[model samples]
Target: MSWHPQYRSSKFRHVYGKAASKEKCYDCVPITRSVHDNQFCAVNPHFIAVVTECAGGGAFLVIPIHQTGKLDPHYPKICGHKGNVLDIKWNPFNDFVIASCSEDATVKVWDIPKHLLTRNITTAKKELLGHVRRVGLIEWHPTANNILFSSGYDYKIMVWNLDSNEPVISKPVKILDAHKDVVLSMSFNTDGSLLATACKDRKIRLIDPRSGEVLQEASYKSHRVNKVLFLGNVKKLFSTGTSRWNNRQIALWDQNDLSVPLLEEDLDGSSGLLFPFYDSDTCMLYVVGKGDGNIRYYEISSEKPYLNYLMEYRSHLPQKGIGVMPKRGLEVSACEIFRFYKLIPTKSLIEPISMIVPRRSESYQEDIYPLTTGAQPALTAQEWLNGVNKGPLLVSLRPDSRKQLKVEKKLPKKENMCLSNGFDVFECPPPKTENELLQMFYRQQEEIRRLRELVNQRDVQIKQLELKLRNLCMNTGSY
Candidate 1:
């Protein structure tokens, strides 16, 4: 039987010190990796990024979705950071830009390659640095591409403009002393106007990104808000983490008035910390940490949340361990696990047979028109109708050199339309799991070798029996 991954647990006590639990944890460890709770999104389904503590001090792991289960020595290494990589976030608009914060007290923006960045960004591309202490958080502006924010133990937050030659030479557009202690976490409101910050001081502060104004501040005097989860609605936020201050409480807060939580609930009898991949869509959150390695799920809703307790499951990781990752599907716990497992490279893994990168066509234009059904809206109505008969796309350069906007307009009345047999690039062959395929090939070779050895042994035995029968016949004739 194949070993399962479900048996992995935090400690002997985590399985309630039962023999059955120990066996279960053992069955699951080899195949399973850690997972976070999210109503939607598979666990590490597709690794956008990874922050790890490895032999080299710290490492950033990037998994190219196209390279799924293959193991290669070189993947993506943005380089430049001098210490352990602590966090990573993909540029919300341009999936091309990735931001990673490090213990080196710097947050560097990397250009994620569609295929691979054979060259590290630091070798030739400019590097951006601003914080004086270990950077703790790096968040992209919810609304714009050029804007992003960084915070660290420096007791200050700095914002950056990715477009400039001097990313940080430009004074931080805004600065705020967000907390009395190290700012453990910071996040912006969904609209990009407000920023919520959590700190070692047990206080959560909301700031105006444009003006660096602290509009409201609240203290979980009963406990500390280790992380502040902002509801896009702006006036409200949900928080989870250790209650060094509520016995580790989970609370909902109205940022408009941060004096008191709208609602608060103590964790189950067990002391646990709130750490998870929070989902804005469903308003549910995952909490993990403290004494247990299991993840807890909760739904937060309300001017103040009532903190309805949800399901909990074991996520194997070291104590005081930490992880927060993307959620792209409903309970993608396994997906997350797959990506996590891919982070730690193994010996003798199969390397993917990759295709050569395609170069842009010689005739490719910098301002290529978009493909729409029927016509280019930029053309006159009659021209649009004519273009519809020709094809669905029209390339235009007349608008402006800098802003060549190519708009798509739908064709009307398909009464005489004829379908075209254009080939589909999307119909590429389905992929095979690199690991599973390699195992099958290895097993087949072993089976063939074993069969040949068995055949040789049978031949020798038959020869011995014939010789013995001949000896018996000779002895009878002598008698």
Candidate 2:
């Protein structure tokens, strides 16, 4: 009944032989929010952010992934949320911005310092208040910049546009009330047309973002669903959680009609929650479990059963949390596609795992290469604020961009303790004073407001042209 026996995995090697330093003291806090929900450490091209709990309580630590060191004594991480921070998400379009939801019932957006090498840089850009109970989830729209969706213990999902031009008290554009229980996780479709939410009630609901309507609903009576995600470009979905017998399970179902899963398989029971990272271009789903020393991936295709077991990559140590770098951040020259930053808090180390395809010939393999979603925002911050939503642009990695990587023999132990492949690591300058950062933050907000006004003007002109056309048609019909 489970695919564990049938699973096969490709080889994965450690990218950085040494672990990235953890700034905080190691504590035995589990990564799961509840019995089923798994928390993800947020990552971008520039930095990785993790919520840590020490003797002093919780602090949101944002560290440069490229650099390794102890916590800067003066700049002790950003401590905005009064209660435990449950989840954090990096803005897909803006590398310098991140959103964190906490048990304090608040979602705060922080502006990351451009230069991380300095000390004492903590700037809270905006604190969002709407949920009545602990807020657990905050996700940025895939295509829309600054448009964020958040859900909490109060069983309400709120849509927000982070344009600081408006008053702090009136930022939530829409408050959706449907879930009878806590909303566990949510995913937006490729085109941003539909939002699928998984609730603690063991039901998945497909929602109309514009109308706040529940278009369809599916139930899994077996057990509570932990995570639900939309399959790339396909009208299908995947969910992972527990079964009635308290076994871990993964299921694939049709989005239009989730009456029954196309495929459902049980797995070995473990307390660690499995967080899935999907690559739309490759149609591969990588499942990384907290407290597990391995990653299991499966390839999805347009066929019966839909999912084909690929392979698992094993390691020596378990992870407290994990963050995945975007596809655009991979080193294309090394035939690398995915890179995972594994957090080992016990050792105060962060390790990188690189998944690469082996090549022998000096030519690009057309079959294995596909265009990936670009990080660029589909619309400017102003356009997103003006109710414009669109899919992201795709960047093609073809011909010259793809190169054959020479396969090397596996190294033994500490002998291979060196950074592999050539990757560019940009250094951030020293941190700026709080006064200087506040001035820059306000200036950026003003610029976004002016851009919004220009977009509004264009909308008026477009409406006028439509009105004239309608009048001309009416006159001709009357004649």
Candidate 3:
């Protein structure tokens, strides 16, 4: 019998339903001859936001996937951008708050009404203006609430604090002006310390957002880079772009040095851009190309050539846009790890595709559970501005049923063994008395306390020595 039954795709419903109709389509008439990997669709824990380019402009549709037709007679279809809506991202912390960018050259933050299923139209809660050209990218701070990052064709990356209650000009808190060409894509490391960007000038740059300095920069003369991403907890990067001869390629690089890529592979030339999505818990990277019908995934590990091609999922209908659901939104009961929403422009529908692990047991298996990526924010925006580098907030997604489903097993040392004399012998020693175990625990705790004190003393001495060296260098008139 199969060990895992819940992981099969045939068990779960694949098509959630079309989000828009012929009368409500976002981009009824194509304005441009191309569709870029804009990350146009975004899904939060509850709702999914999709950008459809309209003839005159574009519209943002906020539809409840579970309640698209049943709960609400009409879902909220937001029209705020004067031009095409380039991208939309839901706030990680707030389900109702969404940030969108447009060709109108502005980023608007919208706060959806409480009764989102019934609400038809929603307006912007705040408007941020700084980019002189079309704003195409927007990313919220993973850990810090009310903070956002945006990039535009003007070659500027602006960091804004959305906590401000003022209606005046929304001045950015910090601006990064390093890229000479248009920023094609921008992504933050898991902790939000480093910001990686791919530009049209064939360069990939890592910037320190807090200090506004280029931490590391590398350029490739081949083709225009499309995306730069940081995966898992490793100090490495992945980039997708075309080579000099117009051959598509995906390469892995070391974060410290970009003199040469660690691993590189060539793909068939296609007009659609490749969008990468990494799952830190499972160390899997899903690569989906815009306007393509297949999703290719690779399992990344610490071994050489980190990316190991896993498998691919193909559909008859090519996707115009794709949105991945957050980990928490996945169906854990079905042993599902990732869920994707693929937008079929021809049908004017957003179909759901789930990736599940096939398992047989009815129990919740702890061994096969996925670790959620970006579980917690490392530092608050205010703290980061204050020059603090608090590490990530680690969280656990262990369900309560896990403990109940676990079966206690004897350790190898404690199990019975067969002796040479053909007699069974217990390998484990008899259980120690309560007081004896307590004594051992106390001794271990004492050693831990001693080690901690030594560390503290060493830190204090190191600080004092640094101060003395600074004073000595100043007195000697040397740098």
Query: Candidate 1 deviates by what RMSD?
Result: 17.1
Q: Which parts of model 2 have CA positions greater than 4 angstroms off?
A: 1-36, 54-57, 69-75, 166-170, 361-367, 380-389, 397-479
lDDT score for candidate 2 against the true structure? 0.71
Clashes of each: 23, 5, 10
Ranked by TM-score, top first? 3, 2, 1
Candidates 2 and 3, the one with greater lDDT? 3
Off by over 4 Å in 3: 1-36, 53-56, 68-75, 117-122, 370-378, 401-479
The residue-level lDDT of candidate 1 at 112 comes to 54
Per-residue lDDT tens digits for candidate 2, residues 341-454, read: 777765655667777776655354555557778766687555755667788887755533322211133334443443354221121112245534543454355447556967
Best by lDDT: 3
How accurate locally is residue 218 in candidate 3, as Cα lDDT from 0 to 100? Answer: 81
- Residue 366 of model 2 has an lDDT of 56
lDDT of 3 by residue, 1-479 (tens): 76855442222223122223333333322222226457678996557787754456667777754443332223347877788888899887666778888889989998875454454454688999999999989998776767799999999999998878865346899999998888888888877778899988888999998777998888866545789898737778889988877777888889889877888788777767888888777777888878777788887766675877767787777888789888866656557778887777776666677787777775665654644543345666687777665545644445443333332443344234555554433422222454334333443454475569679989999999999999999999994
Winner of 1 and 3 under lDDT? 3
Give the lDDT ranking, best first: 3, 2, 1
Candidate 3's displacement at residue 255, Å, is 0.8
